[model samples]
Target: MILKKHLKSIMSVTLAVGLVLSMAVAQPNLGMAASADDETYSGKTPKYVFMFIGDGMSYPQVSSAEMYLGELSMPGQITPEQLDFTKFPVHGALMTQDSTSFIPDSASTATSLASGKKTLSGVINMDETKSIAYTPITEALKEKGYKIGIVTSVPITHATPAAYYAKVANRNDAYGIGKQLAASGFDYFGGGDFDQKTGPKGADQHIYEIVEGAGYTIANTNEEILALNNKSGKVVAIDPDDYEAALDYEIDRADGELALSDYVAKGIEVLDNSKGFFMMVEGGKIDWANHANDAAASIHDTIAFDESVEVALDFYRAHPKETLIIVTADHECGGMTIGYSLTGYSTHFDKLQPVKMSYQEFDKLVKEYQAAMPSDPMLSDLADEIEDAYGLDINNLSDYQSSMLEDAFEKAMSGEKPSDDQEKVLYGSYSPLSVTLSHIVNSSAGLSFTSYSHTGTPVPVYAMGAGSELFDGFYDNTKVYGKLSVITKLDK
Candidate 1:
């Protein structure tokens, strides 16, 4: 009896020991560089940080991009290319609702991410009452001597990017945001041109002039920016052509266009300083494309953002122990979901392969054609343009699709404006060609969108590198700043 009892106790002890060994192997040794065994960073503090914001990028957005990439695989290619950021060690769902409403706007959501607090819609860093104001993470880091870099695929003064630097009552206060961008006096700013050039209500001088007046060297071309030798001074580079308010969508960009990752690499080159740095790169056009219900365009822009992720990953590899990289979205726009009712359990994702130009480009194409052609041009003329832009076979189009285009073309020929309902469904633009083509392809591909505006769904968060373990588990959007503070030891 005594021997049996002793054997039982021994077995229990052996099992317990095995469990401990397994747990130790499963856990990562935080505060140490990914590739080093150096003890210099033996504590929970990051020296370098990167925060990537995919505007309107929620779970559906990420999943869509993944599946689309899968469909693009070549025949007999066993392993498809996955999104680079999905391999992050820590993942979480962030509740993006603000203090005021369930469906939050960009300004309020960005305010929550920028500061560890909730604020009203359209208000920058201030609370709903307009009395309590919070300093942004960028401002906080800037005060600590960390170099700051901001890059976006939209206007540098857009809501998400502006939340980090500008504090204002209204997001439409573009001129004010532009002035703040100049006066922020951080280190680097790269993206599209500002929506407003000067003052609160359209002042006389251009915004670039103010930025240059503040001692920033503005670069307009790829060669000019890449060859920049002025490492000590602040730099600002925006595309010189003011065609669209933001950079071109990746799907429609011309040859030799600078990609989102190129901007990220350039910002890193310019902002890497001795005191450390905090840089933000935004995939702003993902939200814009989703707003237009353009799945192909959104996926291409998401790929662009992933390329920027790769750029940061190379930097993280070199300084893994001191660097922290986080990728998330401020809100979920378009209420996207897979498995559309038309396809049930099956979908033809390759149907999206035919889409070429973006909805905006298609709208512009029709307008230009109409302006140059005679008043009573035949339907084949417009049909040929649509076929060319969308890869649609007009002969194969359903009658309903044909009628949709015919009515809209007739309206355009008569110079009639789009109705309120038409505008809401088609991204506030008059384009039956774009609407019909997208509907035909997207339905077959099993992609669907619930609304044209932002949804209250929680966005996904992916993080890696030093201090990355702190980002796991679900949390409020405001807690982003808190987690960042704890992980980086910003308060200490």
Candidate 2:
């Protein structure tokens, strides 16, 4: 009996010793885990930060872009890299933009992301009481001795990009906003030219001159921009008006036409100081096309935006630890929703054709058809135009369908809703072709779009690099600004 007791005591001692040794080894790994929580920035200061905003992009937008590009591949669909902004190593969801109202405008949403605070609709970086509520991440970084740049496909003084550097009660205050942009002392500013002719009647006639006077070497062409040596603290602005005569998509092919990605790469090249730099690149036109209900055009622009992300991702591949890239949207426009199947339930979008014509092209065709016809042409005439543009044979469609389409077209021209049948055919009832195509794109490539207007839906945020850990779960849009500030340590 004594021997039995002795054996049990020996076993307990052995087990206790084993546990102590195991814990001792795990102590080092636990330190590594704790270090992950503490080590926000890598050893080197971030030499560069790129924030790409696809304005008005929600999950539906991303899905629509994917399905549009992939058609209806069943087994292995295309990946996000195939889209314009592609995919990120880390991603999270952002709250649906909400201001005083349920649906927030671009200005307020952008302001939230830029300043880490919610502001009123139509206001830039200002709160409901018309007070300048917050300082932007760019301003914070600039104060910390980092070069700053802001680029967008839309006008430079437009809502999203302007929120980063300008403070104003109204977004329409572009002329004044331009002056503030000039005075901000950012290293690079590129994109469409704002209609500075409208604000406050006889305001400053030389806002561009003001920008040039602020030690910025202003240029209109890509050649002049590329030729610039890093020594020149330059600000290059591309006037979209100068290229107005050219087709919108063709402008990028011009001698000086620069893609948004080109601006991003150039900004990085020029602002590669040892201290670091912060840049924002916006695919501004995706929202514009969606607002106009131009599915093809929106998909095309989404592809372009994805390409710009690829440029940043490539930069990260080379300097993974030193750069942080974040991609997100300000809000979603067009209330876009993806529908079920158009024909039968086959899980394939076979009826739709790849959209080749621009929204302008279809708009022009519809206008000419209306102008040339006598007073109130038959339903057949409108169907012919839609058939030619969409490559769908409406001849065999039900009389109800045909009538509905004609009525819808007439109402569209007159700026009114069409008859019931026409509304059903044009916008779809149980299954909308436009919305269905958007879903096919999403399901195929994990890209899908829902709705045609800015939805009260939340958008996704994708992040990568040293500070990406901050974008893990649901958070307010303002948190994005704070996260970037924390990761870059710009607040210091």
Candidate 3:
């Protein structure tokens, strides 16, 4: 798991330069100083804008990833490690509450981020009443002739990406969302396939047909996606191997597989124009991993998300003055904490390195095992599998830990439903054995989760390049859209 040489060099140069600047100015190397004159930022607009959303990311998620990388790079010692977006020249915090409650889902939070307005949970780009649609900044920019691109590790029509264009009362209306995506006429759309291409009941028009009829070239294979260039015109590129679901987690990604960074890099090539462009790239599966309470999987996805930010940073370096990059999250998920009671005050993030795949992937392994075995398998039967997948030594488990897994294994084997309360404590709607295994492994690494759902935590925002100073103050998530509006001079 060596860092790519080019990305490593980019990070080194940025860190070195930031250190020198900090020494020269006698201030912390966190962000560039804001000017006292309000007029200094007026009428300023970036020609190239990249907005990166690490879905379900917050301080805990970011810090754990940094610490994990630090441990990997320099074991047995404490050292500062930073992800690329964290090195930006502006830093801020965002309150994630929505109209419905303090704790929010992606639909509402993303709506506030995109439209400068509040909405009920599960609503997208509309007011709480859902009667009036709010024009998001992406549509505004598109109206002004800037090419727009939407990319995500999840299906394009998912809540976060849909906030940019699709307006729906319910986020689950994937068919309706797909129609809006086609009507968006945005320059590029790349990610997983539509979550629901033919409506929930399979009675609606195919999403692919709508997109093609709207003049988009669909690229569903690696070769087709790779061949897409600036001249490819309007395109929709999905991972050919996993067309129906999210791209694989970074920990599970294989050699030559397409990644979030690859999509962002391709987006820049296709969206670049004289009038400039705006690209929204989402690390969508970080949230999914977090929801499953898989620390190793979430950490790896967060790292992959940072690498996607690095792609934008590379672009920023080439067009420093004209480019603006903003990185933030919709909300925090999993209530992930760095220290666990079992480990007391010490954390050993390096312990997570041995984990080989995501809980989603491991669940598949469980299914395969069940199908192949002639008889019911015992907890002992999965020793080698558990060791290989989660770095757990089943034989070494304490009696209490062993008991918990044994009970879960029995429930999994019986194929009987557990009570809702039991489900929450044991699996939270995922495969029972998989969730239990992650809990065991995470505790070993001094990591734990408070809940298997979203938390009422505010997420951090990082910005650099043109108009980045405007993002330096703490605020509600709605102000994100306000700041971008002011930066780009979007009409109210």
The candidate maximizing TM-score is: 3
Every model's TM-score = 0.86, 0.77, 0.90
- The pairs that clash in candidate 3 are none
What ranges in model 1 sit over 4 Å off?
1-42, 74-81, 229-232, 377-379, 411-423, 426-430
In each prediction, how many residue pairs overlap at the backbone (N, C-alpha, C within less than 3 A)? 2, 32, 0
How do the residues 68-159 of candidate 2 rate in per-residue lDDT, one tens digit apiece? 55664543353332453445668788874545555788888898788777767898877667854557778878988888888888888888
- Give the candidate order by descending TM-score: 3, 1, 2
**Candidate with the greatest lDDT versus the true structure:** 3
For each candidate in the order shown, give its overall lDDT on alpha carbons. 0.79, 0.67, 0.87
Residues 1-492, candidate 1: write the lDDT tens digits. Answer: 999999999999999999999877632211111212111233556677999999999987888888888878852343345699988989988998876678999998888888767777888877677776678889878888889999988998988999889888888888888888889997888887788775656656888788889988888887877765437479887765435668899888888887788888888888877888899889999998887778888888998899999999999999988899999999998887877886898766677787888888887877788789776666678667767777777777678767766665676566655667754564335355565566666776899887778899999999998877767888777777877766655666
Badly placed stretches (over 4 Å) of model 3 are 1-40, 420-423
